[model samples]
Every structure is written in C-alpha cells, then in structure tokens.
Target: MTIRFPTLSFAAVRAELLARREIALLDVREEDPFAQAHPLWAANLPLSKLELEAWRRIPRRDTLIVLYGDHAGSDLAPIAAQRLAELGYTRVHVLEGGLDGWREAGGELFRDVNVPSKAFGELVEHERHTPSLSAQEVKALIDAKADVVVLDARRFDEYQTMSIPTATSVPGAELVLRVRALAPDPATQVIVNCAGRTRSIIGTQSLVNAGIPNPVAALRNGTIGWKLAGQALDHEASRRAPEAGEANRAVARASAQEVAQRAGVKCIALDAIESLEAPDRTVYRFDVRTPEEYEAGHLPHFASAPGGQLVQETDHQAPVCGARIVLADDDGVRAPMTASWLAQMGWEVYVVEDHPTSARQVRGAAAPVHPDAPVVDEVSVTELARHLRESPGTTAVIDVTAGVNHARRHIPGAWFAIRAQLAQAIEAIQPARRYVLTCGSSLLARFAAKDLRSLLKARGSEAEVSVLAGGNAAWFAAGEPEESGWKNVATPATDRYRRPYEGTDAPAEAMQAYLDWEFGLVAQLAADGTHHFHVI
Candidate 1:
C-alpha cells in the first residue's frame, strides 16, 4: 500500500494565513515577480538566496516558515522547504496555490511594487500578442538619432563580451534595484535587453510596471537576435558601481536599522543574553557576519547567519518560539537588522555588544563548530583539502553561483547549482561522492556544503561535503587555472518560462490579512505558556 501525504489546498492555506496571529510570509519568486506587485508584508527570499545567503538570514531552527511562489506548480516551494529543513527548520510549508491561488480565492494582491515586464509578460501572453521592435525599427530609431538608451539586462560580464552597440548593462531583477543609478534622465526611452526573450521580455515590462515616466521596450530578442540579424554589437562595458566602501556598508547598515526601528524592533546584549540560558530555554545564537568574517573568526557560541537572508527567512533560522535569541556581528548592521526582524516576530532578540576582547576571544577559543558538525565531530579546511588531493576521482565539485556567473566560468566538471535549487539538485546526485561547493566567494560554499550534507542524510543518503578553500574569488585571486566569464556562451533556455499576472484588490486584502494573522500570533504564542517570547 502506498502512503498518501496531505496536501493543503489554496483556500486552506489562505485561511491558515488569515487565522494566524503571527507568521512570516516569504515569497520565493524570481526578482521580477517581487519587483512587480507582491502581497504586502511579503519579503523576497528568492530561491537562489538559499545557496548564496541562506545561513545569514535564517538563523532560527524552528521559526514558522511559509513560502509562496509565482506559479502554483513553481519549484520554489519544495526547494525552499527542503533547504529550510536541512538547515534545521521544523515547520515549513508551501502556499498551496501560490500568489495566483490567493488571488483566485479572493485574497488580496498589491501592485505598487510589481515588476511591469513580468506583469506585461502575463498581459501580453494573455492577449497572445507581445509587441516587439524589430532590429530594423531599432536601427531606424538609432539612425534617426532618437533619444533612446539601450540597457542590457544581463550580468555585467555577459554585457562586456557582446551586446547591442546602443546598450548599457542594467541586468534584470537588478533593474529596479539600480534603476535610479542607471537612467538619470526620465525622459529618455529605456530599451532593456538580455540574450533572448524571457529577461528582455520581463525586464522591459518591469520598467513599465514601475511606471517609469520614460518610455521603454525590450530589444527584440536581445543580443543573440541582434547578432543573427548581422547587426553590429558593442563589447565595451564597466562596473556599474565599482566603489563598494564604507559608504555602501553604512547605507546597508542604516537601511537595516531603519527598517527595524520602524517596526518597533529591539536588540539584546551578551550579559542579558546569558540570563535566558537554561535547560528549559531554547536559546539560538546567530552570527550575522559575512562567511569570510565568520570563518576567519566569530563568537565561539554563535552559528553563521548572514543578515539579508536572516531578515528574509526568520522562521527557518529560528523555529522554536519563546526562545532567547542573540545575534552577533563584526559591524552592527546585520545584527541590528536581524534583531529588528526577530523582534517583529515577537522574539526576545539581542545584538551582542562590542567588547575589546571580542577578536581575541574568538581567535583564542577553539574554532566555531559547523552547524552540521556533530557535537564531537570536527574538521578544518586544511584537512579537507588534503583529502581532495588524495582522492580526486571520488570528488565532485559543485559551483553554486548565479546562473549567469556559472554559465560564464566555473571549475571544470563542477555542476552548477543555484542556492535556491541546491536542495533539489543535490538530491539527484551521487550520495557516496565527496563534494566541494563554491560561489562568488567561499563563504556561501562553506555553508552550502554543510547544508547539502544534512539534506542528503535526511533522505537516507550519506554524502561528505566540503567547501572550496577560498571559493571562486579566492581561486581566481590566487591565479589558478581559472576561466573568465567568456568561457561558455550558450544562450539561456527560455522554453519553460511563464509569467502570470492577475489584477485585483487581492493585494490589499492579503496585506491586511497578513497583519491580522501576525497580530493574532502574538496573542496565541503568549497564551501558550510553554513558549517564552521576547521582542528583538
């Protein structure tokens, strides 16, 4: 006899959300879905975020985690649930019908933040007629000297290799995030491009969704089509914002702090943190610093938790409610931001205060244990590297980077797995193989290898996982046999692409319902004496 698992329907999930007193609503859609309208109180934890920055945002092992995606059949739900569970979350669920289901059920939806192109894609597809500007039309505009700026919505590396001569790199998903910096002149028509249809289709519509005053459209079929049409393309490109210094850190920190304060969030200190520790108390300490910083040194008692993801995935990080929570950071930015979100969840959240001996303490103490490392188990990079050198054939190298980055250059034979997709990807691989995971930097790779092993074990598979000593950046900086982003140049696949948009008052309803659900959770958790609660 086959066992049947319970599957919650859309109405049921929506009802659960409506009845909840407190819950974290995470949307695991692509950046485009999120940029276009999303349910109010919904935060983007793009499926890719898991591999790249999971440990940072989600430090709690038992926080209630509910995720939704664009399509009902979207792969994000299971992927997120699996990753969260591997990371130690006890209760994670997918929204039964995704955003569309909620809307169809008369739930609320919001438009202010919606990405126009995605919405437009749905609209165009709904009408079965997406207007396109032919190369001739673009050339006519260029020859006529029209006031237009072509924006390549691919990554900077891709833009550098080849792009429409009239275009500048603006990368999809990043378009809205960095729009203001790209186009200062609102009057100028913006032309978004990617290698082919999806991103260009989505990027162009995103600008329109955001209500950009300037007229915008995607370059018909992007650079690939442009090249096929025998049109000249430009190879010149530069870093959009090369200066990532104190100012940028300050901005990120300030934004985090502001968000926390606006939400009435608070932080706890170390001494105060100690008071809550007891056999009955479920205390979770998260180190919200960069992987490099955490690996180099971190609070002896803390686990790695990156800030951005911590905010986006609070419940997955901390599952048990009524627990004393402490967040540590070299710079106060991540800690405060994390504290703010946890506080919103009604947890007693605290940021460890600075101490002169902090650095010395971390360095002098035994290295922090990996989250997946058993109580008595210990391993180091040096030991792992030695194993790699000794057993090359048995080893598997997995490059967990942005699709664009992985496509350009990766360790030879390294399988590409975006963070959000890692759980699923790993499940299909050889469990007996030793694995090394990498991303832009080794930090995520380190965290990912540990998490991947946990997932494999949960499914009755045993896999040994290790991190690239320094990740791709480190590999390149050390001058290894590295390939530039120009190594592989296949056009991305667009056959499975689908963007759905449904207009309604559902966003407004969903937002209020979400707020009501959270408000109720505070009361419910408080009434449950077994659970101890504190505002971070």
Candidate 2:
C-alpha cells in the first residue's frame, strides 16, 4: 500500500512564521534527538506517544501543522501524518527536507526545550531593560541582613531541591499578586530567582510592570549565578508566600488589569467562551492558579495550569501555536497577569470575567487524558511477585515507563524498554517463555502489551503476554523486590531530555555554556523573525 503524506517546504514554513499565522511545527522524534537542534517553534511530539499526546496538546483537530524528524529510514513523519489524519487533524504535512532541509533553507535552529519562551524573556529584558543584581550584590545584602527578601520563582519542588539561603518559593504568576503581601513595607527590596534566566527575568519584571512599591531585581542568571559565585545554597527550603489580604488583592487586581490592557489581553465571559467552541476553531481553557488551590476545586472544563509554568512551558502545555486561550482565576489577578505574558508572546489570550468563586464543579488533580485502552490479559502484582521469587527465570518483566524512572527503580532484574521499539526490545532480551509489561500504573503498559502480543503472534510464537494488573506502583506496595540501574537495554535511553540547568548532574562548564546560550537569545530571535514579542 502506498503511504503518501503532503509536504510543507522550509520556505513555506518560514513564511508562515514570518506572517504570524497559526502553525504548529512538530518534530516526531524522541525528545533527546529533537532537543539537539530544531526550528525555534517546533514542538517535540515523538511518534511513540503521538496518539497519547496529540489530541490533548493540540485540542483543535483541524489545526494547521507541519511535522519533521530524522526518520532513520523509518518514514516516521509520514506515519505521524497518517496518525494525525486518523485522529481528525485536517491540515497535516511532512516537512520537505526535515532538519537538514531546514538548515539548507537558512532557517534558524535553537537548542533546548521551550526556546520560544526563553528567547522571549531575553527580548523582554532587552526591550524593557529589566533590572538585575549580580549574585555577589545579592549575597552582600543578605550577609548584612539588609532590608531585602529573596523570592524563588521556580516550582516549589525545584526550590526544595536547592535554593538561595532564606529564599521563599513564590512562582512567577503569583509574584505580582502576592508580592505586596510578601513584602508589605515599601522600604524592602525584593529579589527574584529561578533555575535559570527566563523566570527570574519574567518574575522581577512582573513586579516592576505591575508598579509594585517595593524595589525589585532579578538574581542575575538565577541559582546558576549563585552556584558559580561559590555561595552555598539551602536545601529542603519550605518557606512560601502567604495568601493576599483583601487590600492587597484590590491593589494587585487593579495593577494586573492595567498590565493586561497594555499587553492587549482580552477580558472574556462564559457565553463568549462557549461561543469559541465552534467546530472550526480550537480553544484552550486553563486555570492559571496554584495547583493546591485548583485541586481544592476548579471549573469542570478548565485544566490546572499554574500561570508561571504555563508561560515557561507553553510548548508543553499548549503545543498548538496560534490557538486561542482562555484563562480562569478566582482571584482576578493571577489569570490577567498570566494572560499578559501570553498576549506578548503572540497568542490571542483572554481572562474569564465571571470566574466562579465556588469552583467546586471538579476536585482533585486535572483529569488524566482519556484514551481508549486496548484490552489484554492481566497478571496481579502478587502473582507476578510469587512467580519471580518461587519460579525464577520463567517470566521476563519489561517495564514500559520513562527511562529516567525505570533507571531509578524497577522490579528486580527487569529490562527497561522504550515502547516505540518494543519489538526490538523484546528481541534484545533473552527469549522468555512468558512476558509481563508494567509502567507507573499500568496505563501505558496496557497499550504496549497489546502490541507485544501481536508481535509474538506474527512470529508464530505462542508466548504468553500479559499486563501487570497494577504495574510497578502495585508491585512496590506489595513489598515486591526491586532493583535500580540499567541492564539489557534494547534502544538508547533517549526518551527524556535532561536539562543542563536542572539538578547537580550538569557540570560547571555545562552550566556556563547554558548561561552563554541564554545571553545570545536576543540575537537569535532577531534572526528568526516569526516571534511577535514586545514589552511595555
């Protein structure tokens, strides 16, 4: 059978970017390779999880999309195009020359994930001249016990890992609304920091843009700057900002609204939001509030997307560029402040005007993306454990989870395999009489088991293939034995991309290189004129 995919040329894609038209340029390769070098706006949607992720990240089925990848002679881009068509995506095409074609066409490529937002941050600082104090200057004030407060703008977990001494976790979107309450005295100087440059610059500028009375500055280069300066950091820091009082809310609300207006963010109501649900257009509804506040209660239709992270990870959250976004916030401050950033990033963004006070329609975490699970035989955790212990070597356990998680821990002697390469992974392991597949909760394993069963059938082998009833999570709960480290790997561990700025794994040299790359983003943004970013 002939498998033909419509192709989009690099020149055409570049034209769309330059025109500021809605286009989602996707790379259908594993994240590791995709992160190495791709066009500025390209989002990684690996073919392995295309079905699992495409419908959600791209809520609009008819969105204009162009895909490219290093197919390794596998024709992955065409396969992805067909898959998208089956999922009801109307306008899908393969990139004519893929990555090489992009380079040949004089297209600018960017490294690392979330390049758009990071580059926009540099542009914001360049245009607005956002204020900053070097790590040395910030340390001097702290050592002197001067009138200053350090607010870490990264996520709480990242802050808990390692943070500046006496720094509190108050993520980006919360900065504008919570700053006044956190530092009531106008005399106190406020400093913001993140894992790297983007959030710190955005967070500090948010306060400055909102016209907060306190003096503010970003910790230059963020925690990386602190580490390079040879200063010790605090681990397991639990300090956080308190909720804003009514007086502070009033001030934050008014300030945020003005900033949103300046950035061209729109105010929308429920009826207007419903009208956007037309068949031809895609609209994303995100509640840009704290997860804890959202988990307590949120509108049934809205997903929990904290404002700061949404701006940082727009590619991950809203992969479809140019899609309309409606943000919901009960406080009337966080959503507008978040919307302001989105507006500046060339998005048609809005904040709900009549956000519900009693947002009790849904509770707990955002509902997991619901895809039809393929039915397969199941083995209970206790049964698998008994077989592995009493009758060792009879059954081979294949854990179909993220490589990082599998390396951290798995059933004793289990082999880690990327589901996309399950056939090759199965062949690499010593031939087994039976196979049991498991993931964090068996959700993904269920799908992999179905594929494994068909592979065995095609080979005329009657090997039994079953999904572990509760997956890895259930096994640990049952006190099943486990082991760490990689063994008998079929494919390279390229599923997850390790950020150079994250954890202590990256060396000082790599950290310096990351900072150097950030410092040059303004120039790159100029070379690739698709980004319609500006600052007030």
Candidate 3:
C-alpha cells in the first residue's frame, strides 16, 4: 500500500508544532548545519543515523513527527519520514522547505532548545507581560544599582568574551533547571538577555512559564539593544559565581544524593575499580573529563565522556544499563556530581579510587589501547590543513572549551562542541570521513581524535582521524586571524525528557499557580503557590 504522508508549509508546520503540545520536531540536517541554528523544539537526528541512533529516544510509533532538511537538494525530509514510518511511527510529517522555508516565512531561530520563541510570542501577546526596562532603562538600573539579576543566556564563552556588566551566563535550557541556583534571593528580579530578540524573549518567558518565582523580563533586543543604547560591555573575568549559601548547598547535596540512590550508583577508589574488570564482562570505563584532559593523558582503557550530560541522560550514555560503569576524573567536582546523579538515574555507577596524578596515568603499563587510535602527528595535521584549504569538501572542527575561551578566540572553522554533548553530538556528523577533533587544549583534541577513530573502526570504517597538535589555543597562539562572526545554532529536543508528575495534563490549579508565579515572576513564593510544584 502506498503511504500518503502529511505535508505542510514551514509556517503551517511551525504553527502546528507551537500551538500543539508534545510534538516532536526532528531536523535531519547534518550536525554542522543543525548547529548553525534551528528552531527550539526541533532536534537533530541526521538521516544517516535515523535507523540506529534515534530509535531508543524516539520510541513512539505514532508521534506527531515533523522532519526537515536544507532547502537545497537534501532528501533528508521524505527519507526521515519514510524511516520513521518503517519503525512503526504512524504519524509522520515534513516541513516543506526546511529552515530556509522557516526563514522565508520570517520565522526566527534560537541557540538552544530550552527557549521556545513561539511560547515567548504568546507571553508577549498577553496584556500583563511588560518588556523589561529598555536598554536605556537597564543602563539606568546599572547606574542606580537596582536589584535585578541580568543573565546572559548565550553559551558561557560568549558571556566571557563580551557581556553587560554584572551579567551571569546561565545557558538558556539550563535557565529553568538552574533558576534557584542562579537567583537564591527571593527579592531579586530576573532579566534574561541573549544576543538578539528571539532568545531573550524566549529565555525570559521560559523561566516565567516554568513557574519560577521571579518577576521576569527580557532585555529589550538583547546585547545589540544594549550596545545601541550606548552601553559599555565588559570582558574577560576570572571570577566565578560565589558558592551558594548553606541552604542552597544543602539542596545540591540532597539532589545529588537522590540521584545516586535512584540510580543504584556508588563511588569507588581506583583500587576497587581495578578489581572489577572481569575481562569477560563488557565494563564500560568512561573518562568524564574534557577531551583535552583525556587526550593529554587519560586513564588506560578509559574513553572520554564529559560529566554534565552523563548524569542528565544516563540511558543514552551507558547503553549497558547494568554494566559496572567506572568513571575517571582528575578532580572530584564532575565525578562525584555525575556519580550522584547516575545513581539517581538507576545506574550502577562508580568513580575510580585515587591512585593516579592525572586522568591519563590511571591505566597501568599493560592497559590495552584501541588498535586504531588516532595519531596526533604534526606532519599529518599540516597535510590535512592544506587539503582543507585546497579542495574544501565539507570539513567540521569542534572547539570544546569553556565559553570564555571560545568566545575570545577559537579555531577558524570549529563549531561549539562542549564536552557535555560529545557522545550524542557525533550522530550529527556525516559518516563519510574521520573528523578532525579539536579543543582548547591538545589533551582533549587528542582524546577526541582517538575516540572518534575508535568509533569509526567499530562501525567498520577505515576513516583517517587526527587531532590538532595544540587545539584552538595553538591556532590562536600561532597568529591565525580571529573573526567575530560565530553564529549561534538552534538545538531542539523532545517532550519525552520533560517530566511533569501526574500526567501529560497538568492540574489546572497547579498550572494556574505555575502561571501566576512565572507571570508575575515574583522572586519568592508565599505559602499560597508552593503546594503545586513537585520535582519530577
């Protein structure tokens, strides 16, 4: 039987996605293009890995799925819908012309999945929603020392390179999750700002809609607006957010504990970890550190897997759910935090006991290295660069560093690949060639190179892999030209990850209270609205 699929113009598709609840918007573009920018609800599940990687995350056989690709000649749209149908998904649709169509329809894009512009548009449409002080008003607030929290919702790197004075980088998606962490004082009003209108509006309203107890508003037009208002931006700070108070710290500690208990997770010393490798059991040893750290030197047999995401999505990370998962970290920060969360997520998680000075030295002299590990040769790198400069087939470079370093300066062609998204991020890449992995430091670049090489080999590809000898730091140190045209790409997600207790339909009273808290955005809640909130 011929399948007659649903088709809609980009405008119609987006309207349906935004107006409806629980829609899955899938972008079949290769990772680089997807990273360039996309809609908030859209997720990148490349057409290549549609059959393999997307199954577990997108299990619904009848999801209201919308697929798109580059407007040019990419067949990803129909192909993806076809694949989803084969996987038993009954309702599959495609955006007529991909993002180009959206742009043609004057639709805006965002940097991260956390902020939904359509939702923001809804907020702006309401009578009660007021624009925060314009750039002029904000500058006055800064001048008057007003009690407002101005948050930069861009990546941390952008915040570090240039940002409004006293601004904090609370990445957009994390805005709601980390709201309490950012604004502990109930009396402090919150202001969300991004580079432009879309993220600022979306970021602000997302916090409001998520039931944050703060009077929330967007920076009018964002940083650009601030600049046009003749405001001077600040740059290069070594300062970090001060440690939270005892109460907040306690919450973090407790959250970690809950995560650990739920996941059946534990932390073990290096020696204890050493005893568990039964040789036959497929124990996955992951190094939850930056690629630079991993490459410079990592524990023997340890593959690079950064921490933030390891905890957030454990199942996608540790496929062997019951396998003895061992993590390696140079310091306790990520390892413990990650282990605690993994435990909460139902994993048998553990951290290697202390014995090595650095993550690299954890393995003894006899640890086996994957046979096809990438080689970090200077000669090979020079040849690769020349090849890139010459014919220039699509080549992608990732700069995995703190937001500050990346914003200040990064490799010319590298896109943002923070360590957190390493494993899932790879699916965004085309399976054609081995990647040129890079980071701020050579350690991570080397680690990424090896990891990518191993991944390719496992897939039966003989792709050549290499790492920049010194990463982006070296690229800058060598006097390469640095440009300021880095474009923020849109990242999309599924409603599947959102956990609201009870059911898909939130209680109207609870939702009313939630809207009230988020709408007025009073920093602290009185006894009235607190009852409806339950952490899922």
Question: Candidate 1 residues 202-305, lDDT tens each?
Answer: 55654554445667777775555565556776666664522224654554455555655654655555667767666445667777654555777776677766
Pairs of residues at least 3 apart in sequence or in different chains that clash in candidate 2: none
In candidate 3 the C-alpha lDDT for residue 398 amounts to: 56
- On TM-score, the candidate that comes out on top is 2
Model 1: weakest 10-residue lDDT segment is: 494-503
**Candidate 2, superposed: residue stretches over 4 Å from native:** 71-73
Whole-model lDDT per candidate: 0.55, 0.88, 0.55
Give the local distance difference test score of model 3.
0.55
lDDT per residue as tens, model 3, 366-422: 232222223564324455466567746546565555444665666555555543234
Candidates sorted by TM-score, descending order?
Answer: 2, 1, 3
TM-score of 2: 0.96
How do the predictions measure up, each by TM-score? 0.41, 0.96, 0.40
Clash counts for all predictions: 50, 0, 28
The better-scoring model by lDDT among 2 and 3 is 2
10 residues in a row with least lDDT, candidate 2: 354-363
lDDT of 2 by residue, 1-536 (tens): 54587899999988887776678899988888888899999999987787788887887777889998775566578768887887888899999988899999898999989999999999999988999999999999999999999999999999999999989999989998888887999999999999889999999999998999888999999989888888888899899999899999999999999999999999977667888777755789998988998998888778889999999999888877777899998888999999999999988898989655664568899766746878889999888888888988889999888999999999988888888778778778877788999999998898788878889898998988999998899989988788898875767788988887888557889889999999999999888777878777
